[model samples]
Target: MEISLNSSSNETTLLADDCWEFIFKIIISDDSCYFKSLSLVSKQFLSITNRLLFSLTISTLTPQPLLPSLFQRFTYLTSLNLTRFHGDLNKLLCQISCFPLNITSLNLSAKFTKSTIPFVGLLSFSKKITTLTSLTYSNIYSIHYTDFIFIADCFPLLEELYLINNLCGSYDNFEVDFSDSFTLYKLRKVRLKRQSINDELLFHLFKNCKHLEEAVILGCDGITDDGIASAISQRPTLKSLSLSDTFGLFSNITTHFIDSLVSLPLTKLILINCCKYSYAGIICLLSKCRQSLQHLNLLNADFLSDQHVVEFSLLLRNLVFINLIGCKMLTESALFALVRNCASLSEIKIEIIWRKSVQNPDSLMGFGVYPQLKSLYFAKSVENPDSLLDFGVYPQLKYLYFANNRWLSDESIIKFASIFHNLQVLDLSNCVRISDEISKLEVLNLSETEVDDETLNVISRNCCGLLQLKLNFCNNITEKGVNRVIENCTQLRKISLQFCDKVHNNVVDSMLNSRPSLRKIIAPHGLDLCDKKKKLFLSQGCILK
Candidate 1:
């Protein structure tokens, strides 16, 4: 039997509304700018994009009378950011409370401005919205100890709290009261920055908030190791702790503090600028939590040496991510030890500076391949130009940040392309000698490099899948090179051309017109585009910065 298909009916039958909505959601997940482009397709798409917006940021510049219409249009918003709203915050909060919205996360962090917490408005808002679980109130001019108690009372269901005040020496005069009334039973994560919190406040929190898990305290000089140990001893649920920049002549992470941490099952530990610490104390702490700790960051720990790294790396078998940014004493030996021991390690950020001349740097090479390693931020300086050649290939590595290496050249780029075949993101900023070829990268940053038109042409030919390209301060490249990249890299979404002297306004206009996929363009300073042109670019779903 022969069957004849009706082509006309097949062509006319469209996808269901639900199926289109699902497809739009997946597309926006990768690039939200697609929502703007999709909204222009038809009225159905416009409605769908409006419904998909789950978050909105409102600044003080936004008219108060238009908020109701804006809120009504984006009814699915569950997160509201009011960090830029510097007007009468109390009145704004009362206005938001009247809206029929279920906002779960609210950010009132006045990062660019200084404002006190709107206690009166927050109390009224809390009564209407009990679903808020996260609150971030940072960069306030001043906050009394009573403000924290008031916050706990207002949001009893808050699971995460970030309270950061501007450290201006005003906290010393305020009196703090540690009472049972300050209760946050549901609080699980708390970050206090530049606050004058003492042991009594720490004890009150640990005692009242029974389920606390993560705590980050930075620049709080009043917190002592003994106070932390005593408080942590009672809380077994604590998994992550970060302490940084505790200012005092005698304040530092001592053996006693390390010993206290050994009993807790911490998965993440970050200690930055904790000037005085014993090598033996750190070793003991690592040995105790070897099986549990997965993330460790020891920034500005200049005392760390090659011997110390070799000894402690053995205890980091299950470590996944580690940052040793400012440990100047560490050499290539530390990197070798970590790769040899930590089989599950994926990401590492370290600075390796070779102080002495080596007869044969190849002798420091280690054994085996680490396919699990994907991201590496290695900023190094070595006397030997062939130092990078000794390092073996990372077959599965995708993200590499080898910035500020003056010795990097064409040979190193070629080696990288051959070794990291799956590499997608590469940052070689501040490497003056590199004017070479690269592999098929998604994101490439060659800022402050010596790349010219010839080099860019070679890159545009190879990197067809490039999404973002940053060429800031690359004065050699002209409009010819940039236009080639814009024409060839069809999937390009963002490009930065700040301080490129040879690329003028005509090039910028051509870039906007040529690539329909371009969402953002960081043009050179003083391009002088008119308001009409800017509106036209916005209409075409491209932003000029």
Candidate 2:
């Protein structure tokens, strides 16, 4: 590994083998001590070592003392995780991440701590980073749309980009440099997470990114059905669209929108919260995109019935991630019948809480075998003795979420846990029934459950390979559950507790002091508590402005 650094180095004060050992130690142990020791060897050693070590760091724990020492080493990076970075980010932009920002991959999360990267700084970064294929930016503050035009100029060869949860915060108007048309022609996947964009910019992206295979316009409030249809009409290779949480995309005038997708290579559509969509509209959307579609999600807009589901799934023989969570009128045959036809099905989600069927016994009992399924979410399903499916069939099952179910009993959970022997994660949040069986799952998530000390003890005892455990609103839990997690899970990285009312101040301190592996621990949102734990949590990758 150290020999790679010697390729660029002209100096010979530091031996390659000696510097190699320090990084090896840090990778295994995540130890800062080894890194510090290596940096002290010589100026050459310091420069190479810090650049390598800080390439994809959380940046909060990455000391600013190291940046001035290591800023110029940009060639070793492909992915830079700097959203949760500490220190002067805008100034650091002038120093690091951008100046020599010719690296290929960058992930700037929307939850950034500061309003840095003015147009000039971002533009400079884009000029050098021409080899970039994938770009992800989040929490983008009031930077101009023209700023993006500058960045778009750099991504001629770019393929995948995630521009989610950003505010195009500068001037309201944006001008596109159509000087070169095929700027992002090679692009395949694009995710515009929280955008409020106009039709012109949307049109430009669609027209330019003609080769786009999968795109998700998540929460783009400004985009309407007419605008999308018109823009996408020109693109032939477009597929895999997720308009999830896009409430504004719905329209009574659906002719133009429906017509555009009829001959396109469109597949895998998601309409999570289209309030105005009737079953007729859904059927129309499906009739157009059903042939090539393998995955479909229509979460909780409630116009779909068992009849609609049956028709849709028959055409989609390649369906995989089918989620109809909260279609109240859906019968068991709609899912079970569809599962039989969809030989490639892997993940399934529905809205059936802990309550048994008083209205339709046949619908409840009609649920059948999901032999090839891996993950199943009974989103609001209550635990009933007879309403459960045989878990032995789902041998590959990993994650099972039964959140927001209150009628599940202790015995119901034990019986359920007995089924999936290879289960990795299980979420029973809001399952108010007291229980210990769920805690035994490898990675248990009972954030809003009513499990206390005794139940948590079962978790620490049974689930030995557990990596992450969420006890967000489990105020009944004191120290036992936490201690179990700290003692057992050495690979544990994140722990979230947004409204855990029972966690005392000392418990938080002990978690910080004891577990070196704990990278993140979010607590109850109170000003006083936040002030106390601010510095410590910052190192855990939760940056505060």
Candidate 3:
């Protein structure tokens, strides 16, 4: 079970096949496409990769007759996705039911066609595979209200269900009939999006499910705040609730609903594009769930101001993740207040505001280091680049996304990179002013920036451990600069050069010949390879896109 790998020093290192499998599992968990390269390592790796295949996505390209062989080859598949299969779903389900596979999760989201759920086929499939516990049917053209009753009967033990139907012309006329004989007693989480889910259906779900814990209702305008309060009052086990794009909620209505949920120990609440709620309503909810809440997302809530965030910051001491995206009224003061109060906060996302008046010189200065913080996302434009210097370093920060920050300069970039020693992923896409060299990073994105040949040389020298580099719109980088990166960065696996006109098709061959670790190359425009040439690259374990 142990394999020996000879290092460059002629030293033999013995590793168990189980350890290699575990490492491959981690890589595939991040991206499944890496399996192709991993399998090509050795026969031992090929066997390990086969066993690691626990989930498979069956699309239109998948041959119907090859299902049995695929299942036999990888006998541990427990999750199946048929969202893009354009053929007869009924027959496909019946065909798959014959296999002795222990599939627990199934996704039938029809993204290509406007097909309805194959109730007959699903009933047959459920009969064969009683181990199924999760079902998803998103982006389907239409589904009747009565279909829920059939789904309850088909998959009685389903723990999670996602039904995202598209807006149809006859959605308003859908029936609201529920049978008392059928109940989803085991259903714990349900997400209904862009459907005609009215108050009656919502209450029926809460009343029947009994143990329902999380409910996400997005773009459903038929349910009012009163209905939500009444339905949620019935389910004491409900801990997470998400409502998005709901126009029926007002200031008073929202406050009333929040008051009704005071008895429940809610842990997570998300309200997106529901801007009618007053600050008092949000504060009331936050205060009620202050002891238990851990995650809060209020996206596109235009009513949120700095005062609102500051007032609620104290209640969010236990909050781990908070997203305030699209709340245009909030300033840097709101962000600093959360960092000061929320001791356990790990991730923070907020839009940078552009104000005409000059900011206070001491606004962004002197916030103590927060070791718990790991990721930060700042969208839109940053008016003052100098303020970034004052934001202190976070030693544990790994992922930093400052995409679309037009005013971000080299001085701020160098200062920020020097502080976060463990920074692994740095995304400065569309920050056109970033032309300086950064420190060693695993994944770096400089797409749409002014990164030139000199900067690439510097990065190749410093970031030799780079795995993925994206330079899509870096027009100043030519073939010589790219060749230097390919030669120096021996661990580079993926590189993108989509719009660099100076880089031609000849560099593709050089990349394939020079670097055996290269797996994916997004070539520039007007570089179309023939089928034979593409196969040649694939033979060398490189995919040309």
Candidate 4:
């Protein structure tokens, strides 16, 4: 694809190098004003937009010669993000010693305080990024253990490592000797948050990164349970293991970590809100990863009951995204045995904390409309909840989080929003007897519901494909139901109206002059609107907090 014509301008053509590298990978932008307006369109579009400006983000309120003129006009940067860099660490290590050391993903973050410790010379410039491979240093103000062993001996072809929530140095009376842990044998994905990571330096950094594949240990309180079952039995290419909120070490070793993942063949296992584990070791780790489990998050597991989540909804059945959120002794026959046996379930998050339905949600009738269910939250039921009104026509239910169902009335939420038909994010927050129908919803949360103004003029005459509307404390809305939802949703961009104190300030200046494509309005502090209407709400680009 070579198209060259530009005989010194006039007919201006020239686009080739693989169509400017596929338009710089489809215009990936960190807003350098779209490559400074296509690099003033010429000199071969400023040398292929400076080789697609391969990622650069220096922030600390920029403009200190904008980080040495963006590394002297982008010489093929390979990802660099020094965001929140709170100034002068020897002028950001003399502008990161004129970077371009072929940076292969380096994100050094910083904000300040904790006695500011922006120790640049990161391992004395790790021989200028010897082809560094992914390093995300987070929330830095302090970090030691020989700066985490000279940034893990300056990335030996490092393969992904994110150390979040920095701050850690005082090795009180010196202890951190994890027998030479700095190993990065081509590391394979490791995310350790809230550091000071222990367990003998996280099992001596996973016994020298034996090709560890995806291990995210959040809130690492020096991980226990035999240092995570000896680093999950030496990662045989460990497949996605996210141990979240890690103190309570998998609720006191859920049956020896499900007998150390009887031969890790895991396909995404996230133990969220990790505490109180072991419902027969989570139904024997879902009967040994029921044929390679597909994303299962026991969110707030509350010791899953109802005959062990109805025998883990008939043995996983190759489950696909199951988040038993706050499992309050799950019933309705364990969500009709997981919508009649997983069946490639797309996404299901439970929680109807009692209120009847030990079974009879029409006795788990025949299972018809699941067909790869598409997101269903259904939380809180406070009695007489008519167990999901005889679930059937799911038709790829598109994001439905029936929040605080207070006896979901209104003809059972318009017969469950009339059988899906491609609904889009309908979160009836605090469902005060669910009002009006969901006309092709597009992110409607009805905050503390019982919507008024005739459900905002029936969501501006049938949800005109609404875009982000919350109505914070629905104090029976005012301002003429937010000017009939900013004059008929007209593609509204964001509205919360917290504590709707009968909204004043001329209904927030006529809903920012009838939504000039509203961008954000949260309200609540009694619409005080002054300082020339908050600089005319930031001069119309909107954002009346």
Candidate number of the best TM-score:
1
Model 3, global lDDT: 0.82
Give per-model TM-scores: 0.92, 0.75, 0.91, 0.33
Residue pair clashes in candidate 1 = none
Displacement of residue 37 (Cα, Å) in model 3 is 3.7
Off by over 4 Å in 3: 1-31, 41-43, 166-170, 246-255, 352-364
* lDDT tens readout by residue for model 3, 1-545: 11345556433225578887776666557466677766765677777788887789999889878999998888788899998887788888998888888899999866666677797689779988898899998787766668888898888999999998664523564558887776899999999887766888888889899889999988775777788888897898899999886544433455558776776778988988877777777788788899999989999877888888988998878999999989888887788788889989999898857565745755656676677777777776557656655666778888888888887888878888877888899999998989988979989999999988889999999999999999998988899889989999988989999988888779987887798788899999888778887899898778888
Task: Estimate candidate 1's RMSD in Å.
Answer: 4.1
lDDT of 1 by residue, 1-545 (tens): 01133556752136666777887666557455677777776676678788888888899879889999998888888889988887777888898888888889999865555566788789888988888999998787666668788889889889999988764644554456768778889999999888777777787788789889999988876778778877787777789999886675235666667777887889999887877776766788889999999999999888899888888888889999999999888887787788888989899888876647667767655455677777866765544546555556777887888788888888878877887988888999998999979888999999999999999999899998899999999999999999899989988999999999888768988886788789889889788867887888898889987
The model with the greater TM-score, 2 or 3, is 3
User: Candidate 4, after superposition: displacement of residue 326 in Å?
Assistant: 19
The most accurate candidate by lDDT is 3
Off by over 4 Å in 4: 1-148, 152-202, 206-229, 232-282, 285-308, 311-332, 336-456, 460-467, 470-484, 487-512, 515-538, 541-545
Q: What is the lDDT of residue 223 in candidate 1?
A: 73
Q: Which ten residues in a row have the lowest lDDT in candidate 4?
A: 166-175
lDDT tens digits by residue: candidate 4, 358-399? 545565455445656777666664465555556667666777
True-structure lDDT of candidate 2: 0.64
Error of 2 at 264 (Å): 1.9
User: CA lDDT of each candidate?
Assistant: 0.82, 0.64, 0.82, 0.70
lDDT of 4 at 195: 66
Question: What global local distance difference test value does model 1 have?
Answer: 0.82
